[model samples]
Target: MAAPVPPPTEPDASARICPGDQIGPCAACHRPTHKYGRGARSPLCEYCDAKAVERLGRKLRAD
Candidate 1:
């Protein structure tokens, strides 16, 4: 027997983000990361995740 498909539901979930064709912000820098590629789970497309990590280190060192 074939499996039944679930109908589409309304999008009201706060965490349910659906980027039609745009990339999300970087988790670390919180900057726009669309120039690189389509994504939003950290490790922005424009730059590497390490870049942000380094910046964090610098900030912590200052304090």
Candidate 2:
């Protein structure tokens, strides 16, 4: 048997505005950054993402 085809869908507005590899601000901090894949208007920069992970670890430990 063959697999059924998936239905088409409209493209996201953000994806149209900011395609993959486009520079955008970090979600946590207002810092210009890239490397966020497609339509990421507010993606976290490396530093912030690392800090968030650290914070999460601490929070988990405290609990």
RMSD (CA, Å), each prediction? 13.4, 12.7
For model 2, how does the per-residue alpha-carbon lDDT over 1-63 read when each residue is reduced to its tens digit? 944422223222333455456756657665555634666465655556567778786454323
Q: After superposition, how far is residue 20 of candidate 1 from its true place, in Å?
A: 7.3
TM-score of 1: 0.29
Over 14-52, each residue of candidate 1 has an lDDT whose tens digit, in order, gives: 214435355455454445444234533553422334455
User: What's the residue-level lDDT of 19 in candidate 2?
Assistant: 48
- Give residue 12's error in model 1 in angstroms: 29
What candidate 2 gets wrong by more than 4 Å, as runs, is 1-21, 58-63
Best by lDDT: 2
> What is the lDDT of every predicted structure here?
0.40, 0.52
User: Which pairs of residues collide in candidate 1?
Assistant: none
